[model samples]
Target: MARLLLLGAGHAHMTVMAHLPEIISRGHTVTAVGPLSRHYYSGMGPGMLGGTYTPEDISFPVQQMIESRGGEFILDKAVRVDAKSKKVLLQSGREIEYDVCSFNTGSSVPQSIVNANATDVYSVKPIENLLAGRKRIQSLADRGKISIGVVGGGPAALEVAGNAAACAREAGCKNVSVRLYAGKVFLRHLSPRVRSLCASAMRKHAIQIIEGSYASGVATKKVTLEDGREFDEDVIFIAMGVRPSALIAESGLPVGNDGGLAVNRFLQCDEHPDIFGGGDCIWFKDQPLDKVGVYAVRQNPVLYHNLIARMEGGELQPFDPGGEYLLIFNTGGGTGVLHKAGISFGGRLAFFIKDYIDRKFMREFQP
Candidate 1:
């Protein structure tokens, strides 16, 4: 029997776990490793921070799903991949040998701009950090007025800033304020209309949007602009985009410019065919993909099929990124901005649509 080692309990890996019975029945032993037993759905993470959903509503019991399906689950972080020996090194000093391996390791926030002495600083990753930030905001607001600073110009930063304002409001703290350091232009990559809608939404929540400069450094309860101006904040959130897990590049494997595992159309490693990957952790050779959850969700079936085919000596299917995806930003106060195919709209109806879709997705994977 061949051994399959699955690294990280990400979106694509979750689908694999749902179909584990088929793989196990094929006489293949499966082993999954992750830093956390439960994987949080990043799509609804900002809503959870805004008190729109509970933690249990957006997280999946991945460890239970794997263990119940005759697969072994290890609650440990993967430190390295010894490709030559076909073994994975864990943070706990254990080595696992596998005939085949897959990575859904996900991405991480860049921390180079953060100072060592920074306090109350959080990253919009792992999804769980938002909960902690929400609690901190409530705590600080209980005493008096609190200033929260969010640094970044991307969609993640916008979501964080909007939800943070809602989090305080839900906690019954009216003295809370939010400032978004949106660099040169807010949502610069998006259409002008979408950017304007997002800015209006932020203004509706009394959030101050600061542009024309990016954050150069973050220190103790302070964010410094690139132009040498500093703003004091009770809490700070860094949402300056994400980078693929360093484990792939650190293991000396082939990587793209973004340091993600370089893979082909079949989602198989260019140099190591036995090594497959999806999600934000892989750099597609055919084209560059945005680091969005939609791509990860779309890769689920393709990865599941390819992994089984690789083991069974069957034909493998290539992955198609598909057309433009629908994006809905939940901008607090039961409001959202929906965009698809260059068409955009905003209102309560937009939020309702997003909420329905998000909840439906959770129900599909969460039993």
Candidate 2:
């Protein structure tokens, strides 16, 4: 029986966890190494920002799930991976020898945002911290005018700005403003019609959208843009992009230009054939796809196939992300945007659709 090691509890790793029993039944040993025992559903994070769900709704116990499937779960960060030697070393000083290794170490907040000294600014990648920001926001309730400035025009920024607006209204706050900043190219992955629909949705919800710009730096109750435009905001939400976590660099594995694990179409590193990576941690050699949870979710089946094939000495089939796929965004005022196949849909029904998709994704993968 071969021993297989899975790293990280990201979406793709969690998907493999569900099928772990089959691997064990076939006599292959299974073990998962992760820093946190809980995994977060990033797609549903916006819902939590809108106060539609709780922390429990978005988190799942990884350790319990792995054990239930007869796999050992190691709640420790993988510090180093010796692909040539087929061994991995954990932060807890444990060495794990494996026949095959798969990595799903997820991305983190972009360094551009994190390294900047932006007062009262927050990031969206670490949802747990955003939950704490909610409490700080609540404390400002009834204390006078408060405004939140959101940088980036992606779905996450839109979700944060929209949710903050809705939250301010819900908290009975008056004179609250939500401002969003976008680069020259906003929502470039989406079609023009869809972008226009989303913009209208934001405008209708009273979430101000400032396109073709960048926020230079932030101060308490103020934001200075690169173009000299200024905004008075009590808080700044940084929701632009994400970078692969530092654990990757620490692992001593080769990463791509995008700061993610370099992998081929089969999700295998060139120098480390046995070390496969998926989720946002991967930078596919051909075309670097957008960092979206939908892409990660779509990768589950292919990752499953490759992992199962490795156990049986079978060939792995590569999966390609299409040029365009469905893109959904919630505007935080109980409305959202759904763009698919060059069509756009929005409103309360769109929010319901978003909710259904998130709930279904979580339920199907429940450990």
Candidate 3:
């Protein structure tokens, strides 16, 4: 039997770890290592942010699930990989030897962005960690009449804008001004209907949708745009660009233009077949898809096949990500917008349906 190590309890590993016995029964040893005892899935994070669901609803026990299948589970971060030796260097100073490895460690914001002068700044990643930062924003918002700026136009940014507004209202902030700042039109990936729905919902919630402008930096509770315009911001959430966790890029692997680790169709590192990857950390050969949770969720099966194949000396399989994955994003006032196949929907019922669908989607992963 070969010793196989899983580097993170991210989306892809969460999917396959639940079925770890299948991998074990095939005569391979498995080890799952990461800092968290459980993984809070990004798919259900918006719900948590909007107060539609509790934290427990969106989280799953990773260590228990993997250990139950007779695999060693270590709650630690992987610092480096010795590809030639087939071993993972753990931050805890332990060395994990493996015959095959897969990485689902995911991505996080740069400390520079969060530690900058922007005290109100927040990055939409590492959902659980975001919660602590969100709480600080919530407290400041409670003081009333807060000018909130969401510094990105993507779905996650949209959700931050919406959730920030919702939390403001929940904290009883009157005259709250929530604005989204993007260098271009918001929700550009969606169809016209979806865009209209999103804007309409933002308007209804008293959230201002500001487009075609970038947030340059913050100074003394004020945000400066690229056009030299200044706006008061009691709270700012930096929802812009994502970088693969620094350790991944530092591993000396081939990477895509955005500095994400380069991988073949099977999510295996192009330069090192024995070392595999998934989630927001990997870049496919053909397209530069964003590090969305949907794409990470889609990588599960291929990662499962390829990891096992590598352990058993079988053929590696290709991962075919769906052409378009659906997204139901929050507008921040107890409402959300839906997007799929260039189509969109809005309104209260739309938000309710979105909640139902998202909750049901995560249920499949529940034990």
Each prediction's whole-model lDDT (CA): 0.91, 0.79, 0.76
Across 293-355, the per-residue lDDT of candidate 3 in tens digits comes to 878877877888888888888998888887877767766656777777766777676678767
Q: Write the per-residue lDDT of candidate 1 for residues 3-32, one digit (tens) a residue.
A: 989999889786788999989999999999
Which sequence of candidate numbers ranks them by lDDT, best first? Answer: 1, 2, 3
Worst 10 residues of 1 by lDDT: 137-146
Model 1 regions lying over 4 Å from their true place: none
Identify the superior model by lDDT, candidate 1 or candidate 3.
Answer: 1
TM-scores vs. true structure, each candidate: 0.98, 0.91, 0.91
TM-score, structure 1 vs. true: 0.98
Best by TM-score: 1
